[model samples]
Target: MVDRPIIFSAAMVRALLAGRKTQTRRLATSPLRRVEVGDRLYVRESMHLWSAGHDAEVTFAADDRSFQTGPNTGDIPDASLTAYFRMVDQSRAKGRRISRPSIHMPRWASRLTLIVEGVKVEPLQSITSRDAISEGIERAGGEWRCYDSSGTGCLGARESFCTLWSSLHEAPGQRWQDNPNVVALSFRVEHGNIDTLYPNLRSARA
Candidate 1:
C-alpha cells in the first residue's frame, strides 16, 4: 500500500485515460524494483501551470486542455486564458513554451493514478502477445498494432511491443535484444488526482 510516481508520455496517458492500457514494463532499476502489488502509482505527464497565490490552473499536454484547480469551472475563463497565453508568450520570447517535463511534475498535479494489481520480474522480451495488448497496442482493420517513437506502426502486438521497447531503451544493456530483466506491472487506471481519491493512503509505504 505504497504510493509512487510514474512518468508517461502523452500518448500513453491518452491510452490509460481511454482504458486501453493496463500494463507497463520498466527496467528492473532500484526504483521500479521497489514497486509491489497493492501499490498506487501517480502518473506524471507533461503539463504547465499558471498560478497566483492560492489560485492555480493546469494545462496538460496530453489533450491540450486546461483545468481549474479546486473548482467548478472545467474551463479557464477568457481573462485567465489571456494571462495563460501571455505567460506562454513570455516563455517563447526566451525560446520555449511553459511546458514542464513529465519527470519534474509534482505528484499533486498528476491526473491519473494506477492501482497495481500484479507485479512480476522477467526478461524484457518475454512479454506475451496478450501482455503486449495490455500494454496499449491498438487494433485497426483487425490487426493489432502500435507506433514506435518515430510514429511508424508495427503490425502484431508482440512486434509492436518490441519496436516500442527498443525505441525507448537504447542503452547498451537495456535494449530489447539485451533481454534485460524488467519489472512488469499490471495495474488498473484510476482517473483523478491521486490525493483526492486516496488522502489517507497518500502517506502509506510498502
Candidate 2:
C-alpha cells in the first residue's frame, strides 16, 4: 500500500474535481508503464497555481519585495524555521539533476487521492464514445470537420478527445500517432485525505 505521487496539469485536476475525468492514459514506456487493481494515485496539481478558499483571503503586495501568505487567525509559525524553496532546487543549484521528476514530488503536496479500479493496454486510437465522455468531453449538440470551419456541427467523442489531447501535447514526435500503445488506468476519487491510504485505517476497514 505505498503512496505514489502523480503530478497533473491544472486542467486535468479541474476535470477530476468535477468528476468528469475518471481515466488517464500514459505512454507504455513511461514510468507509469503498468498498473494493477487497488493501486492508489495521489494527484498533485501544478506547483505554480495557488487558489483561495471561501474562508481564505488573498492579498497582493504593492511592492514586489514582500508578500502576505494568508489570513489565518491562528498564530503564525516563525519565518526563520522554514526554507521556502523546493528541495529539487538544491540539486539543480549544484548543477545536478533528477532524471524522473514526477516520482519525486512530496506526498504532502498532493491534494487528492484516487484508487485504481481497473487497468488495460491498447492502441492509442481505440477510444470509444463512452470512454471519451469519461475523459471529460461534452457532447456538442454534430461532427466538426477539421478541414473546414463552416461551423460544422458537433464532434464525435473520439474526435473531441483527440482535440483535447492534441492541445496538451502538440510537439512533433509527441503527437497521438507517435504513441503506439497506452496504459489506461481507471480510478475512483477517495473521499478523504490521502493519508488514510498509508496506514492501519485501510487494513481496519478491510
Candidate 3:
C-alpha cells in the first residue's frame, strides 16, 4: 500500500476525529486522480508546537489538545522532533506561537491516518443523501445539518452538504453550481501516526 499526505481543514479534522466523516470529495486534480483503494493517507492539520530542550509538545488546532512528542512519550522520531524544535525556535524568535499551515505539517506530526476503502469519480452535484451523511453531516432533532451550521432551518442531508460545499468552494468554476467533476474517496479512520502504525512503510521509504 502506498502512503501519502493529505491536507484537511480544522473542521474536517474534527469530523474525522469524531468518527463523523468517512468520505471526502476533491476536485479531480491529477494528484487526487492517482489515489486508489488500499493507499494510506496521513492527515495534515493545523497545529502548534512548543518545546523545552529536546522534548516537544504538539497542540492540534482542531481540538486544542496537546500531546507530548518524544521517544518515551510518543511515536515521533528524533529527526522529526528536531525539525519541530527549529520551527518552534523560529516562531519564538519572531514573538509568535509556532503555528503553520496544514500543508506544511510533517508526516511524523500527523495523528490521524485514513485507509482508502473505495474510490470513484462523479459530478459534485451528484452526491446523494447517504453520501452527504458520510461526508460528516449531522442528524439532530430529525434534521440533517452541516456540522458547522446551527441547523436552525433543519435542512436535509443533501441540502446541508450543499451549504458545506459552497462554504469551502466559493471560487468560480469550483462552486456547487459548477458541477465540477470530483474524485470521491471513501476511507476508514485509523487513530495513530502513519509511520507508527506502518513501520514497514517507513523503513521502505528510508
The top-ranked prediction according to TM-score is 3
Off by over 4 Å in 2: 47-105, 139-154, 171-173, 201-206
Quick one: best lDDT, which candidate?
A: 3
Candidate 1 stretches greater than 4 Å from native = 52-55, 70-97, 140-142, 149-152, 204-206
lDDT of 3 by residue, 59-178 (tens): 999999888765365567654667655675775567656776899987778999999999999999999989998998766677765544564644688888888888788888898999
Tens digits of per-residue lDDT for model 1, 1-206 = 78888988887888898898999999998487899888899999999866554345678999977766533333333323454455545554665436689998766667888999999999988899999989986765656555564555566789888877876788899998899999999999998877777755555633
**Candidate 2: worst-modelled 10 consecutive residues by lDDT:** 57-66
TM accuracy, model 3: 0.87
Write down the TM-score of every candidate.
0.80, 0.62, 0.87
lDDT of each prediction vs. the true structure? 0.77, 0.55, 0.81
Model 3 C-alpha RMSD vs. true structure (Å) is 2.8
Candidate 1 RMSD to the real structure: 5.9
Give the TM-score ranking, best first. 3, 1, 2
Ranking by lDDT: 3, 1, 2
For candidate 2, give the lDDT of residue 200: 41
Write one digit per residue (lDDT tens) for candidate 2, span 1-206. 44456667655666677788899887677666645688777775433212233122111111112122333422112231132123334434554432223334344334468888888888778878788778765544455322123344445777777766676666665577676677888889863336534544332111
